[model samples]
Target: MWQPFEYAPKNKIIFGKNSLARLGEITEQFTVKRVAIVTDQGIIDTGHVEKAAYYLTQKNITTYTFSDFAQNPTTENVTAGVDFAKEHQIELIIGLGGGSSMDCAKGVNFLLTNGGEMQDYWGYGKAKQKMLPMIGIPTTTGTGSEAQSYALISDSKTHRKMACGDPKASFRVAILDPSLTVTQPTSVMKATGIDAISHAIESAVTKRRNALSASFSLYAWKLLNANFESMLFSPENEEANMGMQMGACYSGMAIENSMLGATHACANPLTKNYGITHGHAIALMLPHVIRYNADHAQDIYEDLCRISGIVIASCAGKALARRIEKIVAATELPTTLSAYGITADAINNLAVEANEEWTAQFNPRIVKYNDFVSLYNKAL
Candidate 1:
């Protein structure tokens, strides 16, 4: 029997090369006089921010820029953005960068309109007031923040990742312009690509998986699996870039309905403690988690393998695990926990934190502290 699931997508997604040209017209629909463009300095350097500003300015919409945020986007960053928005009396927000920018935008929207701290809206649907309208233009093919309602903001003091979400937080428009992503550095491409691939795999067989989510995940995996190598090999491959972009967006849609699984649960502690990039950490843990969940998600894993045309080695789970491992190896990202200086002594502590991650309970297979310990050991 299929699991019952709700599907209410609030974001309007426009996809194509140079689709960003529509930004001014889309913002005009909201009839907003002032808009805030939330992004990082790196994106500003890429000139995407300037381009976005030009579009909005053509419509006579004044644009305010906020780039004071780190890669992980701490809660403090959101506060700063909110303060900036307040000063400008921002009528609408535009997130023009990668996931961090989009997440920071949503985080600002949550606190700016609702009048509270980031922690107050940590889980989901905590905001009672209406949020300001927002647009998201992803310059990277990962995180898929444009297609979803959750903001993964971290606590500045404690450094814990918090997922803040609300229906109002969803973007009013998402522009997937493949032209924007091709300029990303090779390192960023590899890390974010792996992260997008992980999203598809992890969301496919979560405890919350449903027919709707399954469809998205399956197609996302197919596109991501087929195009990831091409994108990495030739960053200027527009067709490959488009495939990866849509794949990442579809993965985000899947995650909206099904959530994630043990890979994310295990990867979080690594990122929190070692400052490992989220995608690199995910690369280290995903294969191990895939093997661990084999007993419960074997059929799902097999389906993924068949769809991706991977030869089943021993079983579907193993084949899928090997495929992921091969992809990580190709990227030259570290595949073992020890490669990041994570020692066996750290396993117990890491496992404890992993067991407490919000996604742990959503794994198709139960992941207890001991199980996390074992998974970490295997990765090591």
Candidate 2:
């Protein structure tokens, strides 16, 4: 029998070329007067924060913006955001950038309402109190943070990334304005796109995957694989941008239901140790993880290939891995771990850390320390 699963979508998604104009209208639904927009310096530079503030202010809502977080949001950053929100007595929050901004927003909500450190809610559903209603407006086409309840916050001291989640933390609305993504640099586009693609593929065959997540994963893979190259080559194409945005959102939704696998588990340590960008680290590890999981998830891998119109070669897993390699090649990112200056000696430590990542347990195929070591060596 199929595993029993609950399919409840908490976020109402609005997708268009310029749905950002509806931000004020959407905020009004919560009947909140004081609002906080959590974003990044880069997005503020792009004027999206100003545009969002203008819309909210026009509706007679008092607006505040917090952009003190780094690209990988830390617990200290969330604490700082909480202090800022407390000072202003903010009513509602709008996450208005990439994953970092959204995650920082969620992390703030966790503490703003339910007073505690990020580590208190490390696993899931640990918040004992209600969380403030928040909206996610993504300016990038990846990370799918808009569609998730979890906030990936790094610990300040140890630099460990924590996935803190609760039902109350899910976004009330996700505004997908493809136009916002056009302003990103080409390198950002390539990295985030690859990250989204990994989300779709990894979520598809995880141990937690069920019917609901499977549908999302398959469709997201189709959209992402079909449009990734176009989004890179013709960044201004509305159709391509929309496809990538929706694909990334769907990938996030899939992750919400199913979680991820060894690729993310392996990628996290690379980001923490070497400061490798998340997407670039994912690119280096994903193909190897796919091949590793083939013994148990080959059928699922084959399904992804079939849906994306990729003909399987001798092995479905190998074919999918090769396809991902080809997609990575299209970008300027290096495919090998050594290219990032990650030496062979570091593989042992990276493997140990990878084995301990939260996503490691959910990998369809069991991943041990030695297995991670092998995967790292292969990537090297």
Candidate 3:
């Protein structure tokens, strides 16, 4: 009784403990000469960017660093990065931090070849030309931007995050070295790990979910649910770190085909106006959104609860809410907006913005403006 569904395009994934050391080999394989390393100042301060730059330098690939990107990348940042790359004649781009750096790199590629502002490509599949060669290296366990074809770029004028999609913006290769994530702050690790869990949970129950996407989501949920606690308890454990990285990557792949739902849609406004980290904002709102969606997608929610090993009397909406509450408690994430200094009145504007987010349309339950308001109020 299943219908045909389009499959997402595949890309190369290089994952391991020392996979970062292969950057030189990858650059040589792609015949890239001048490369731009896109990252933020915090990554540079961590010395990981220097390590990556050294690898490229040893292979005779001239590396230019772009550390001017903001925490939440804006269209202005993308334009500046594009200008730097063009002026330096860079042929390849390496995104070497979390989602912001990777997103900025994708934005840079989109503007470099398409010759338009980020606003022009706000919707899906807008790029007309091939993008420059790009590689993504994730230093965190969230967002999964390294494995996605879409980049979330903020508009400088309105400060709203635009979800821009193009096959050309996909990375040629993603190098996931879990070792790099060990240095993340404890709060960041916990928040991003919760974000990865949200991806798995959301993808499993999204309206677009199919057999293949379900397969990835189920395994991703298992991996994340099992290892997230281990990573929190033993942050430096290589095996646990690898599990988190692999789970996050799989969730990213699932999202590529199925997209995210109400949680992400609601979370975006918090990041835009409240100055919250993307992962933290998403984590804070996810449990309530999951409960909301469970009312409409009970069968899928029960399936996810079973896969995540949450014992319940039945596969009901309340059972899903209890299970999500347990996960949120385990992560030490804030479960309410008030805990994050957001007021109940803020829900009105956030609801207005969430209703306009591109991902809201894909939720299993139709997310109307009133629904967003309710969800925001519930979170508060």
Candidate 4:
């Protein structure tokens, strides 16, 4: 018999080539007037923030720009953003970049209303009160922060990344425009696309995986697998761009319901320590993690193999590992930690940290500290 589950907080999804043009209409739905546009310096450099601010200005909405967020948003950055929001009496937030901006927006909302540090809401459903309305506009195809209720925030002191979530932190609307993604460089596309693929694969094999989540993951995996290579090899193809955007969004939706597994658990520390992109870290660790999870989640791995069209018939765990290596090769992503300057000692420390990560609890395999150590050693 199948177990029961509840869906995530509902969201309004606006998707298309130029869906960002509807931002004003969507923000008005929540009766927002003064808005805080949370983003990063890179986004401002790309002029995406200016474009979003223009849209709000055209609608007669006052816009406040908060583009000081870091690549991995820290508590201090979030606190500063919250102070800015409060100073302007901002009624709405528009997250106008990748995961960092959206996460900073969520952190600002949490600190603004909840009256505490970002660490105060590190776990699940910690916020007891409501938050301001947020609209997320993703400029990249990865991270899927626009669709989820959680934010990945880092501790200022320890540099440990925390996953903060509350039902109220869920976005009121997500504007997915492939045109916005067109400005992303080849490196951004490669990293973020791999991150989306990891989300699908991890969600499908997680302990929380259910029928509803599996359906989303299957379709997301199919779309990502079908279009990732095309997008990488043929950057000018409109169809490939659309598929990547849609697939990334679907993977985000899947993670909203089922969460992620060992790959994310391991990747977080790599980002925190080495300053690697989240997707790049995941890609470096994913194939090895997939091999590890397959030992315990054989049936689910086989299902994913069939869905990804990686294997024609039943295959052993090694085959899945090899397929992931092939995918990594096609993307030209690093398959080993050594290529990224991650040494054995760092790997050991990262293993300790990864073992402590919240996502480790959802891994299909019972991940002990030694298991993390082994995986890190193997990845290196």
Give a tens-digit lDDT track for model 4, residues 205-243. 788988888888888888888888888888877788888
Tens-digit lDDT string for candidate 1 (89-119): 9999999988999999999999999987999
Q: Rate the local accuracy (lDDT) of all candidates.
A: 0.93, 0.94, 0.87, 0.86
> What are the per-residue Cα lDDT tens digits for candidate 2 across 67-127?
9999999989999999999999999999998899999999999999999799999989999
**Candidate 3 lDDT over residue span 289-331, tens digit each:** 8778766888877777788777768545677677657767877
TM-scores of the models, in the given order? Answer: 0.99, 0.99, 0.96, 0.96
- lDDT comparing candidate 4 with the true structure: 0.86
Judge candidate 1 against the unseen true structure and give its global Cα lDDT, from 0 to 1.
0.93
* Model 4 bad stretches (over 4 Å): 312-317
Q: Which is superior by TM-score, 1 or 3? A: 1
Error of 2 at 108 (Å): 0.4
Question: Candidate 3: deviation at residue 67, Å?
Answer: 1.0
Q: On TM-score, who's better, 1 or 4?
A: 1
Error of 1 at 126 (Å): 0.6
Q: Model 1 off-target regions past 4 Å?
A: none
